[model samples]
Target: MIRKLKSGQYRIYSRKVDPKTNKRKNLGTFDTLEAAKRHEQEIQYFKHKG
Candidate 1:
């Protein structure tokens, strides 16, 4: 999902409402929406790298 950070930029994170955890948690923050997309892509890349 796309989210706005305290820095006034947007970030992307794993979709919430999937596992539906009762508790709230923050995963990351980014300088821009593009940056967030890149981060998510990088994480995905590393996960499948091996």
Candidate 2:
């Protein structure tokens, strides 16, 4: 999932919530939404690469 921060930045998070923290894992933070979306696609590609 992608979320827009108050700082005008974008953050990528895991699809599932972490049981330990009870929150989505922070995947990465990007300066632009486009960059965040691209990174999210890369993550999905790698996740199902095999």
Model 2 lDDT per residue over 1-50, tens place: 99999999999999999999999999999999999999999999999999
Which stretches of candidate 1 lie above 4 Å from their native place?
5-7, 15-25
How do the residues 1-50 of candidate 1 rate in per-residue lDDT, one tens digit apiece? 66887879876656544466753445577787888887878877896898
Q: In candidate 1, which residue pairs clash?
A: none
Number of the top candidate by lDDT? Answer: 2
Q: What is the C-alpha lDDT of each candidate?
A: 0.71, 0.98
